[model samples]
Target: MRQFSENTFESLVADTQFIRWAKGEQVADSQKWEEWKKNHSDKTREFDEACKAVRMFSFATPAISDLEVDYLKQKAFDRSKKQRNTLGTVVWMRRLTRVAAVLFIPLLLFTTWTLLDKKQLETTYSSLVENRMDEEISVVAPIGTRTIVDLPDGSKVWLNAGSQLTYPPIFANNGRTVHLEGEAFFEVSKDETPFNVENFGPTIKVYGTEFNVNAYEEEEVVTVALVEGSVSLAKSGGELFLEPGEVSFFDKSSETIHVERKNLEHFLCWREGKFIFRDASLNSILRVLQRQYNVEFELSNPQLGSYPYNATFQNESLEQIFQLLELSAPIQFDYTKGYLNKDGAYVKGKVRIK
Candidate 1:
């Protein structure tokens, strides 16, 4: 019943309900905690800090049961309360050792697997994208999630939010090919086989290089920005080639491609968790914000959508972003953490801009 506040961190860390929630464990009081969180939006910073503190205790190289973690944490809380300044640090170290004894086993297995296969290949995403062969693998990055995919041929892909990538567990005799549904940055390993990225807009082929490809379902075109090396796109009119620092827009409807000289940094920034806009329109900025934060936006005046703005945002929360946007443009904003709909699906948060 205690809401998180300035002095609540110590108590929250002690609370099993809070600790469970932070570790992503489902507790009986989760519904109550969720409602509390919704009502106490002003304490988000403190709540986040507390949650992080709890999660930091997560075992890396072992597997400690959740109940065990709860017990150790409670003991830490008792010790901290008695010796606030000096003993708190020592208690932290002791608790870390006690828990690590159990958690290290799991961490060791995870590390071994990471070295062998990278992250595990997800089998649940084929239905979200398309039917696949038994040997095919798929990965989906939901809203606000970025997924890294290690392909069979040693090529690596970074899928943007709401994106899906499908490829064979091992490429067909190393004849590299992959299908993408949204956006991704590609770091192709040099090989004789042409790496093919098939999307709704175009088929991009490259021998070796780094580039970004965006083919979101809502967008009518596929955008390919080459960073290094060359890429060729198959279009209806003809084959179009792109060099470094060049962008190719392939329209799905027309099957035509447009080549333009543009800055690769603008296209590559998202992979680094940064949003960089150079003379970008308000509409473009809103689209990027919505994609990254899984939020909705509306322009109070349609004219505001065309207003050009320039800025870079990295690690800024949605509220912080709203403030920065308002200060930069002739815009004021209102926000709503929208409620669940009749079907029990929660609506995305929405921002209104004037």
Candidate 2:
């Protein structure tokens, strides 16, 4: 035989089967219902009394209403006057109807208020090991853009508009290990074995390397371009190395790896808040702006895509940047305060390079 108290009733009501039964979608066997009712007779009566109290108390009005005062007096008299067979099945069915009639309006208002509110929940995990353990990790960034995180060891990372990077909470006892997804630029702290960045299946082992890694899930290839220092790239168990001006592309889907030489500065210029474009197309430049300033661009001119420019700015306002770009480019840019309607002060309309 199973037993249930007040605490268990809340959980029992939370179950899908109980909810269906409560809603009359399905009914439990008559024999089982009778057995459960008999075991919980006393608690069921107490639960009804508490529910009646909740239904009667009105926070909006500090003082009890005349009807509520009358109900309270009658309840007291009923308890004092005589023993009543109110815990029986027949009485329970009647009590349910009366309770719903008294509480329905307030209960509906409470449910509506709860449904409209936003709820945020967070979870954390921790581990303690007597000896030691080695592990690899990965993370999925949320739907929208987020800022890059600077590590404790003076290393800088610029996460792409939407991407996740996961590493040990503390660096390994023997090595510095981290993983990246989407895109990120790293100015790593020099270590003995260097700092290693692994994505997909390939690994970039470097000694103080300044590089940008684009491993976006939509893209078939993972590109790691070295701006400074040496980086070793190993793909599909094969190892290839790069010098300061080299770029390596690994096809994660097909495992085809290629290494090329390139101009490192044009690719790694975001570090100074500069949208450095050697000959970048308008579409490509807007993508960079969208990530850098957290803005949306509606490009109405198809001709704007092919125009190219090179520029850099630090500590400049978005309006100033947009003014400069408008003078140099043929396209016009407009501004609007997106999401201002939802969060009044969160993001204001300030134009950047158009």
Per-candidate local distance difference test:
0.83, 0.66
What's the CA error at residue 343 for candidate 2, in Å? Answer: 5.5
Candidate no. 1 TM-score: 0.58
Off by over 4 Å in 1: 1-135, 338-345
Give per-residue CA lDDT, model 1, range 25-67, as digits (tens): 8788778767867887887677788988888889776878999
* Cα-based lDDT at residue 239, candidate 2: 71
lDDT of 2 at 110: 79
Highest lDDT scorer:
1
Model 2 deviation from native, Cα RMSD in Å: 32.5
lDDT of 2: 0.66
- Model 2 agreement with the true structure over 161-249: per-residue lDDT tens digits: 55788776556546666888777788887766457788874888877568888786655678788887777876656777887778887
- Residue pairs with backbone overlap in model 2: none
